[model samples]
Target chain A: MRKRLRNDILLIGGVLLIAAAFALIFFLTRKEGAYAAVMKNGTEIARYALSAEGEYPITDGETVTNLLVIRGGKAEIAEATCPDQICVNHRAVSKAGETIVCLPQEVVIKIVAETKNAPDMVV
Target chain B: MRNKKTKKLAFLGLCTAVTLILAYVEALLPPLWAAVPGIKMGLPNIMLLFLLYRFSVKEAAAVSLVRLFAVALLFGNIMTLAYSFAGAVLSLAVMNLLKRIDRFSMVAVSIMGGIFHNLGQVLVAILVLETAEIGYYMIVLTVTGTIAGILIGLAGYLVLKYLKQKEI
Candidate 1:
């Protein structure tokens, strides 16, 4: 009986830990930067902002998906290229220290708060 | 009876192939609503668990190596391969060692493997990124890995149980 109780406790604890982690990710952060396009090889490929009230189209010489979503006071690609479309399913990102990357297409959408630049002190 | 060894080798190859296909399939799943990104299903893991119970440890390790390399090559990520390779080797070693404990259930062993795998990957991530910030992600990963471990373990347990009952 003791062992069973211990196991139950452990399982409950594990579930709570996971829930807390997700909550921390969702709530504790403040809004950061405006939407910015991630340019590579001099091409506009990705855009990110404080919220996803706008639309951003992304392409990779083949397929294109117009990603739409809002996160952390910005708007960016909630989806993108290729048949799998897994990237499109990754909804909007809206928090500090959060990132979304499209490896196959070499596109990264990120948010940066304006106040983040205050760390100018030399290391 | 004429080619038992050859038959065994063929079975191993099939296991490895199935695992590779599953790995890619899971990789293609869209991430759910989370700040962090990851693949779903962990389908290849089902094969690994099957081999662990049905075959010897050496055979399971062999299948894992082939599947890992094949998936890495198809995915075209050498860096990602290194992290996964480290995790696979370490997790396999831990699980194999723990399997020797008479009282340890396969479920427990699988859970340990899952935990160690996350630890190995997080260690690699810390090394590759040259930052300690990634360590924070380990807590989240541990919870995820443990849940996945339990589900996969139960699947393996049921399969082994069925095989034993059928005497196959």
Candidate 2:
């Protein structure tokens, strides 16, 4: 029984260590986003530079409206017509790979780096 | 023999009910991390771990599936069902595999189940949302899942100890 307890602790410790390492790598490798890509129904509808501060309204037909605001090198959904309002409540994102998804509106706002080596297909 | 089979069935049914109730209670609680959609304390997993240890893998899997469908039918939509179904299946698979290997303790199996559960959900999110960008959330999810796993695993450990004492 004592051996079992020891084994459990060791296993949990190892997993926590691995998770911490991944988190550290994630934080260190996170880069400032250069563009906010507005995607509707899985397709990139528009791209706005994070360097430029502006507000863009993304609409899907007549039913949905998501107001995306870029300011201070960060992007956020300022207003959303969706009932949940989860997207509007999301915090501003400035790091590449951050995303604000309005599932109701099928709108996805993702941050991406403007890299010369930007892959044609990012998997 | 008939009486024993009836008892087994009754136990499985009771386990399923317990798991569903735990899921419902967790759902009622407000989001721990507003940024993440699927983050939860995974209270139901404690029950699942208990079932896994106290019963057969087949019984555990059956109860888990029933719980998933029941929860989805009562409180979730199609998307929720998709994410949860994927998570539950993957988590069970991992736990069962670990149990078969028989090297790690039950707590270790539970933790691995929790981590894989989140990974399974993330995979579904990537597919359903049609964006690979969601993969970035894996780091946060993994960390949270590990914590939740530890809590659930500890609870399962205590319960297992008590059950052993009672010879249940």
Candidate 3:
């Protein structure tokens, strides 16, 4: 039992160490994103600049599925028709690689790095 | 031989039923952390671990596949099925590999299982969303997975201890 306990402790410590390292590296490399890209059903539907402050309704056909709010350099889901409301309850995200995903709505809001030369508007 | 076959079938059926019930219970409960999407207690995995130890990798895998299809068809969406299928298969692969090594305990195997499960789900999320940025969640999910792994491992360890005398 003692050896088993030691092995378990060692395993837990090692795994946690790796996870901490991953988090540190992620934080060190993370930067503020320029665009809040929205995807519906796994395809890019729209992109909103994080620098801009506005409310954008992410519609699927005629019905709005999610209401996205960008303010103070952070993006968040303000309203969603999804049953879980996990995305709506999420904290606003501003860092690159941050996301607010509504699985039920199949809508994803991701903070992404700005392209060197951007197109006028894809959506 | 026929009697042995009957016993195996009965045991596997029992495991599948238990896994399905656990899946239902897990679904009824809310997410552990609302901010961290798809973080589950993975209560069903306790049975998986039991099967792996008491029987073999084959039994565990069979039960896991059945549970995935059953849960997806009964209450979940196709996307959910894809994510879970990926997670379960990947997690089982790593767990089986580690078990074959014979160095780590069940607790260790289960921790790795939890981690790989998240890895699989993250991969699917990336593919589905077509964005690498969703990998950000992997950081948080790893931490949550570790905690959940410890819980399931401890629970499984206790069960194994109790059943050791009877060899059930």
Candidate 4:
């Protein structure tokens, strides 16, 4: 019984150590993003600067209305016509690599860090 | 003989029903923090863990699969079903491994199950979303899954303790 108890603690401790490591990495790498790039069907449709606060209604012309609200340097889906509304309920994201995905609508709001030094912001 | 077989089958059905109800309750709940997408308490897993300890892996898997399909059909779509099925299969496999090893406690097994379940779902999410960035959510999810796993393990442990002395 004692041996089993020790094994359990060791296993839990090991898993927590890994989780903590990832958490540390996330914390360190987290950066305020500059753009909220909206992608539809794996291709970029719209790009909004996080510095500019506005409500952008992203739609595929008719269906899939996801209101991308950029406020206070963070982006959130204020309203969504999707059934699950997982995107709407999600908290606003500001981190450079953060994303909010509405699978049903095939809309992905990705936070891209646009820096003058790094050259990836040609879009 | 036949009586014992009937008893096992009936118990399986009961287990499946209880898990299905718990799944419904979970489905009704909004996301835990409304921040993380898949951060679930995994309440239905309490029964799955109970069955894993009380009976065998086969029994637990049977109940889990039944509960998954029933819940999906009732409250979810093809997407939800896909991720859930992935989570359930991965969780059951890990839990069964821990049980076979017999070194870890129910809590440990339960925690591993929760971790693997989220891992599986994240994998499926990465595939469907076609992005590796979503893997970052697993960091937050790892902590949430541990808490949920501990709760489930405690509940399952209590149920197992009392049920151990009783006729199921």
| Every candidate's chain B TM-score | 0.89, 0.94, 0.95, 0.96
Colliding residue pairs in candidate 2: none
Which residue runs of candidate 3 sit more than 4 Å off their true CA positions? Answer: A1-11, A41-43, A113-115, A119-123, B165-168
Residue B4, model 1: lDDT of: 78
* Candidate 1, B8-114: lDDT as tens digits: 78878877887887877777665543455442345566677777778768888999988777877777578778878988888888778766643456666676677
How do the residues B1-168 of candidate 2 rate in per-residue lDDT, one tens digit apiece? 888888778877987898888988987798887766667889999888887887768888999899888887897777778888999999999998888877788778888899899989889877877898877677777778888887898898787777655422
Q: On a 0 to 1 TM-score scale, where does candidate 3 land against the true structure? A: 0.91
Q: Can you list the residue pairs that collide in candidate 4?
A: none
Compare the candidates by lDDT and give the number of the best one: 4
CA lDDT of B79 in candidate 2?
Answer: 74
Compared with the true structure, what per-residue lDDT tens digits does model 3 show for residues B64-136?
A: 9999999988988898899999999999999899888777888888988998999998899888867776787
DockQ of 3: 0.60
The most accurate candidate by TM-score is 4
The residue ranges of model 4 lying beyond 4 angstroms of the native Cα positions read A115-123
Q: How high is the lDDT of residue A64 in model 3?
A: 90
How closely does chain A match the true chain A in each prediction, as TM-score?
0.48, 0.79, 0.93, 0.84
Candidate 4 chain B minimal-lDDT segment of 10 residues: B30-39
Candidate 3 per-residue lDDT over residues A12-112, each given as its tens digit: 78878887898898889888899888887677878888888999998888999899999999999999998878899898999987888887777889888
Query: For model 3 chain B, where is the 10-residue window of minimal lDDT?
Result: B159-168
- For model 1, the docking class works out as incorrect
lDDT of 4 by residue, B1-168 (tens): 889889879988987888888888887887778777878889889998988888888889888888878877887778889999999999999999988988998998999999999999999888887777888888888888999999999999998888887775
Stronger candidate by TM-score (2 vs 4): 4
